[model samples]
Target: MLRVSIAQISPDGTKEENADKVEALIRMARGADLIVFPEYSLGARLEHADRLAEPVDGPLIRRLAAAARESGLAVIMGILESAEGGPYNSVVLMANGDAIVAHRKILLFDALGSIESRYVRPGNMPLTLVRLGEFTVGLATCFELRFPEIFRSLAAAGADLFVVPAAWYAGNLKEEQWLVSAASRAMENVAYLVAADSAARAFVGRSLVVNPWGHVELDLGKGERLVAWEISRDAVDEARSALPLIEMANQHMGTWARVRRIY
Candidate 1:
């Protein structure tokens, strides 16, 4: 069984305040194998363009690395990254003080009231896959959830589990979108879906675990909470055996392409 912890808490503008909250939750995890955190929940700087990105050796990632090494834990954390003259939204995966992968968010949310495009650079890499013991883990951020192609790429790369760390904004029926997207992704790819959402006033929290069979194994309500669940590797195989969506997906391949010029 693989144990997972989701930290669903609102974040303040101060780094110390956010880090303290995360540290408290990390300590509560106890024996969890993987712990997931929400996007930009370490500090609220959605409007700030300059002070976003921190180096791998910087305080943001360094702090997470220390926690991982001390607790023998694996973490999937979302942080704003600064690069050259621009900032980027990224998910950094760490294990035992080592960063295994850094997936820069490809889809930037600039439409409507979002100014992400002004500060952040759009990523070009496809969904990145990381090996975790016996299973391959996949990654995707908040806005990336709207695109099914990224998920398909990860599934094609042999990912058995998908981790989504998001600060999903609240809306009239946004919760439904989360439910549908999670279930559909799991069912379509026959993989486990673990989502960590922020419980801030602007962002609704509802961290969840969905099995390959599209079942909700764990659900954290719209409140600040620490939720954990165990999943079996055999369950992944059994789901794929019963419904071979992974194999069937090959028939509908080559449909999505990278956007060359944004309008």
Candidate 2:
């Protein structure tokens, strides 16, 4: 069994304070094998995102990486990243004070009036699959949950888990749709789904972990807190064996089986 810790962060625009909260939570969840943090919980300088961005080796990420190394835990976290051209919304997979993988958000929510796209350059790379223990984990941001093809692609690439760091708004549509998406993603992909959400002033704080059988393993409250759960990889194998959606992945496969768009 693999234990996961979901850190529900409530940010006050102070990067140090947020980092301290995360660090405290990480220490509290000492026995966990993996720890997931919310997006932009460290702080957001919307107008000067490029200036505020940091590399994986920078202070913020380095601190988390250090904690992961000290605790012997794998960490999946979201942060604003600065590179050659500009900044981008990125998630890092880290262990032993080093980065294992970094995935940039491909689908920016610019059309939804989120100015994040204005500051962050859209990424062209596909979803990333990182090996953890006996399972492969897929990385994605909040908005990416609405796209089924993204999950399908990752599942096909042998992703057995999905980690989402989100900042969802406080509304019925957002809440309902997000829950639906989380459960559906787990049910369809037959993988474990862990969603860590920020508990901000105007956002909902329903951080959750859904199993391959679409069961809620853990659900955190809107208040700032850390929740943990243990999951077995055998559950994933069993779920897939029972409901073989993978076999039905491309029912429309013709002579051109490999050439098909994931509508």
TM-score of each: 0.90, 0.91
> How would you encode candidate 1's per-residue C-alpha lDDT over 207-232 as one tens digit per residue?
88999988888889888888778888
Q: CA lDDT of each candidate?
A: 0.79, 0.81
Candidate 2 stretches with Cα past 4 Å from truth are 250-263
Q: Number of clashing pairs, model 1?
A: 2
Q: Judged by TM-score, which candidate is best? A: 2
Model 2 local distance difference test score: 0.81
lDDT for residue 75 in candidate 1, whole number 0-100: 84
Q: Clashing residue pairs, candidate 1? A: 53-81, 53-82
Model 1 ranges with Cα > 4 A deviation? 251-263
Q: What is the lDDT of residue 191 in candidate 2?
A: 91
Q: Given candidate 2, what's the lDDT at residue 246?
A: 64
